[model samples]
Target: MTARANTVAVGYLHALLDYARARGLALDALRAALPFDPSDRDARVPEALGAALFDRAAALLEDDALGLHVGEQVRPGHYGALGFVAMNCERLGEALDALRRYQALVIDLGGVGLKRDEQTCTLSWNPGTDGPYRQLAEFNLAGLVTFARWMAGAWAKPLRIDVMYAAPADTREHTRILGCPLRFAQACYRVVLPIDALDAPLIQPDPAMRELMQRLADQQLRALPRGDDWLTRLRAQIARRLRQPPVELDAVAAALALSSRSLQRRLQAEGLRFSALVEQVRRELAERHLADASLDLADIALLLGYSEQSAFQRAFKRWTGQTPAQWRAAHTEPRN
Candidate 1:
């Protein structure tokens, strides 16, 4: 399918809006600002619009730590399919695995990353390389910590928390809410927790319920729109259908529910061409495929929609001034 706009599910905002309402903020003003009905839990808005709303809400409430408070208010229901799956997992580690796999069901602002060592494991939210996401970052980290506490216990605190943004004028709330050592202006947003904590059993663990939720989550993930903008959506569609025959303009247009002419027009509007876009997608996918050592050159060529290894080699050289094998050799990690 075609890539869709970078959007955030409205359900994620429910906690923030409800938190505002609880604090005596009027609903009418915010409701009027939204393009869709606030009660339409399945609705989504552009990522930029979501950020604007957060800024506006902070102004209206006159609270700088609004994002943290809103995150504190998040319930399992706010996370949609991901929440249910996490709730039913056998242990905290399984629940975290569910979160890592299904985070996009809640927000596309960034990805969830987990790193482990013998003593502790670090769970981090890596926001997109570009964007004004300070508040959203705060919300994400806060929500993750809060949800873990809810599932486990109050004592299930992180060893420390790392935030990407600089320290605000007052961090008392940050300390109070996070309940851990805090570091600001860090390179990434993350929380370090004892590995044993992840082994703790969840309060609610249902294997049957987890299975059902996983199926539903998979379907939702497949149906969700692909990316942050139209071009991204288009590129994603191309990548998905690359291995299938005829990854042409018309085929891609039809996949996105657009006509060939309309798709051409949209690309032109962005000062891009359909052929150029396809080539770009190929270049990107080629690099990614090459990173995996198991895939042979012939397999990589076919995956990129090339009919012959020689032709794929020529394109790779033209794109990167190096043969595919050479590129792979340079990038691949050395064997231990």
Candidate 2:
């Protein structure tokens, strides 16, 4: 009914739950009126509940490794129908497609993308919502690599791993589990897949079974309740398109399958304006891009869709009451 019901995969919570149970944590304390059935490991829960669970677990453990441990421990089966669809696909490429297509059944936050070229394939991830769990980006990639090793081959190492976070002081652990060279604080978190891995045959490929799994996944996905928040959808579309110049109202309306007039009226009904949303999305993206040490102020400006660096500077000043460089200097961490 409410946007609060926007779903997240239960596995994220289940991981914390598993660790807590293993350490004799009073699971009952963390089980406050959660929207998902506690007994169903494969269930989807309201996003609020998932966030709450992560908060509680972090408070209890006080260790960053908790999420990393959970990621490594997530068996392919833990993903439920999504995992089933992926594992049953005929080859590594098909498996990746299944994961991308059915990922909504697991988490409503970020979408997955796969781009293949003559030499290699790249898998890019963008977090859906801003939270500590978004930092679980690392864990999510680690889990995929975990699955990659199983589906592709043990020797199916990545060409490189790019993260949005700054490089850890010691990346041996990342290299150990992720099994790849690391690039940190760049554009976003990405996995560069090896070419040989793409066409590698999956051990459990069954085309018929994959079809059956897809049908079941579709049924299950349809059964899940979706968020009724128009604002959330609008914001998501805007954010996804901010990199493109002059994100037109007509384009966004078309993406939502609505007439421009209807989209305008609906946004007005929610006490929002199309121009206001554009500003909000651009501001958020600007702040995020500025944090990446790899990107210069000019590049950040262009990424946020301004044709000129000066125009972007003017807009950034209006949004944050500081020029882009000033904001970066004040808000971003100093390099060692």
Candidate 3:
């Protein structure tokens, strides 16, 4: 997807603009450097603009601490409200539910969803009406984990992050910033935290305040900013189809209530082919499954719409230079 409809990146750009203004930089000057049209209120700002902003901001600043300040400006009440919600919840599950409900309010670029398995609670992202932003997605995941730790009064342990995107060439900064097990190019953007984390009581709790925050969060979710793009809408539809594997293109078109030809035409207009997008989804899922050693290769292959394990392996190798096992070994670590 073109950068314009990437909510995470756009939100980060918005945050950067605000930061520059706060630092006495001219708003017009900042706008001039960006690709977005300042005069067009409805115009979508590209994700490239956000990337450029981050790169420039990172270079201009002396340290990464400035990024935290920028994040605060981007989502002002995010951490405070999370702390309030955690303290008020009766149990860890309740707190997680509250976090799921409120996370969107902090930034509507992407929404966070929770799934509980027998061993861990997985926090995943449900891309909003906007397409995904790789960097913004990374930042959001990192920020949420850090905020959750702060709320629980446990800053010593790191949150487990699994990303759908491939691992970057440079891992030192990412590892240093996250301080947790990092798996890249996974099937989904998620964090797998031990169930025990939920039982750790909050440092502060107030039922009345938590309820009030919940009300505020609900209101915010209702008023979230939405994207106006075919790619954004199509990505959401593709995500839904992944659950019930072996999705046919025509079926997806029918689900969107558009003719198959029309769907194809629309996707083409957006510079994307439906098949390519489906492959992208499969690649993401493959990466995730490959990282988890417990998941057998055949099972992962079946889940990703591949008929044979060899086919899945070949595809995985094409996506990343290394074999799936090699990639996982390079990324995974023993749980502390």
Candidate 4:
């Protein structure tokens, strides 16, 4: 896999396929396009492929809400160790916290964020630049809701739902499955709930089992082969925080749970400097956005955290010996 590649557990792929088969949809074409060994249940697949499978299955079944439906079928096994850890967590909050910490074991496409206040809490999904793929985003949000309901009770439901995309033509399935007021075209995708719900006791709260599963999950996290190294992780952190403002050393260090001095030392050990890596990430993202052929140089500059298009233009020239427009003209195909 490439440095930026993201992957998901194979179990999720199987779950989607299983849902498709149950609905009498044939899998021949899907298998041909994105083949995977059905026997390799313990393996991982590219997250892109998983998203594609969701898209293909939705098309084949003619179900716009396919991700939501497939997510409803998620069982503990689908998430691997993290699932069991959540299953044994004493409180709903504990379960979600575990998910936040160890979710990369199941999917590494983006991030899961949790925030709380006195009266309410929000769980948000921040997908990558390539996504907020409508079906995949629904799957992620629906899977969380389904897992929460299974762990807490049938009464469990989000207070409101916020989706990053425009409202679909049909929202009946969303309303039926999510059972909440829905907001669309928001800054991010979120599930909002009463804060008290976080304290609700799970149906099965086994402290001993939770501890055991947590150990296994920690081991799995340490063993993750993709982009787990310090340098790669730092680049990813820089990429994420670029648009959030104050993309400085202290901020990036805090995100990585390292002091600025320590972070600098680590980078030095890798024969790198923090500033250099940040610039590298910006250049990479600039190229990626430029490849779309829809984003103008100014938009790409802002996305890369530039205060001015001129600053980005200068940096791009430094990185690639060409102006942003010049590079785009040479590298990307013109739109029809």
Alpha-carbon RMSD, each predicted model: 12.2, 16.7, 14.2, 18.2
lDDT string for model 2 (99-210, tens) is 7656777776344556656788777654434443533555577777888778778645789987767765656668778877888765555788876677788888866676
The digit string of per-residue lDDT tens for model 3 on 1-336 reads: 323344322433455666766787666554434766544432345544555555555555543444445543444233445446655764555567666555544444343555544667666653432323455555565566555655575632445877666666666656665677888865456677776665666656665676576556556544556555454466667866775676678988887788999887665433345766777567656765776778888888777777788987898876555677776665455445
| Candidate 1 residue lDDT tens string, 1-336 | 332345788998787788878988877767645667788888877776776677778888898988888888789999999999999976787778678667878887444556656899776653443554666667777898899889987536899998777889999988988899999877667788898887788899877687688779989987877634555578789899888757789989998888999987666433355676667678768977897888999999999988999999999986555899997876565456
- Ordered by lDDT, highest first, the candidates read 4, 1, 2, 3
- Determine which window of 10 residues in candidate 3 has minimal summed lDDT: 1-10
**Candidate 4: TM-score?**
0.67
Considering every candidate listed, which one attains the maximal TM-score? 4
CA lDDT, every model vs. true structure:
0.77, 0.69, 0.58, 0.77
TM-score of each: 0.65, 0.62, 0.53, 0.67
Better of 1 and 2 by lDDT: 1
Q: What is the lDDT of candidate 3?
A: 0.58
Better of 1 and 2 by TM-score: 1
Ten contiguous residues minimizing lDDT sum, candidate 4 = 265-274
